[model samples]
Target: MRVHEMTITNDFQPQYLQLIAHRASTYRSDIRIRFEKDNILLDAKSILGMMILPFRPGTVITVQTKGTDEEEAIEEMCQLLENKTS
Candidate 1:
């Protein structure tokens, strides 16, 4: 398994956070997510699960992935979170 740390720079507000979370959820189905004051933990491949996390800007998030495609999953997730496209 692989784990990565990320920060949410955009959509720091509550409503935007919700939107981001929802969008992320739509991308994956069963992600595990944990909320923290400065960060979150996302279990790999759990898009839906990660979407429910209540996060704000500057929040730190840890993404963890397991399985044969763990690296790919982590990279994809990082891009999704960091990418400004939309």
Candidate 2:
């Protein structure tokens, strides 16, 4: 398993959430996003699960991935959360 904590730099709008869910679904890894302070953990590949996230700039989150592509999955998820991609 791999895990990384990062602060959200972009707004968690519906489009962004959709992008996240789409990206996550392409990977074979089991991906999860956790808001530690809020005690919320959700399947990153589920649009419905992602919709409940209280994400905003500066909202810290932990991303965890387990499976063959965990490293790549974590990297992509971090890039998305950190706004390193369009």
Candidate 3:
């Protein structure tokens, strides 16, 4: 298992969220995103779950993964949240 702190930067738009879920699903890891303040944990690969998270830009969230590709999963998720283009 691995965890990293990431700040939300994107606008959480529908298209971007679909992109996020697609990225998350490419990994073999069990990934989750959490809003520590509210104890809200969401499955990273679920578009519905990601959409329902109540967060905004600059909100610090925890990205967690447990599996063979945990490291890459976390890094990619962080980049997505940071709105970084690869």
Candidate 4:
């Protein structure tokens, strides 16, 4: 398993959530995002879950991924969460 923590810097819209879900679904690893303050943990591949994901700037999120491609999944997820790429 891989764990990463970072603050979200982007204001994501519904379309971006959909894109995130799509990207998550392409990976074999089990990806989950956790909001510590809210005590919420959601699967990245679930559209419904992604829809409610916290995207407010400065919100800290912890990403957990497990499985064969966890390394790559964590890297990509971090990039997306940090808004390092489009």
RMSD, every candidate, angstroms: 4.8, 1.7, 2.2, 1.6
The TM-score between candidate 4 and the true structure equals: 0.91
Model 4 has an lDDT value of 0.87
- What pairs collide in candidate 1? 30-46, 31-46, 38-60, 39-60, 40-60
What stretches of model 2 exceed 4 Å from their correct place?
84-86
What is the C-alpha lDDT profile of model 1 across 1-86, one tens digit per residue? 67777777765444444554554444433344444563555553343544456544677677665656566666766676677432
> For model 3, which pairs clash?
none
lDDT of 4 by residue, 1-86 (tens): 99998888778888888888898889999999999779799999999889876777788889999999999998988887777433
What is the C-alpha local distance difference test score of each model?
0.55, 0.88, 0.85, 0.87
Query: Lowest summed lDDT over 10 consecutive residues: which window, candidate 2?
Result: 77-86
TM-score of each predicted structure versus truth: 0.58, 0.90, 0.87, 0.91
**Which regions in candidate 1 have their CA more than 4 angstroms from the true location?**
12-48
Between 2 and 3, whose TM-score is larger?
2
Q: What is the lDDT of residue 25 in candidate 3?
A: 99
* Model 3, global lDDT: 0.85
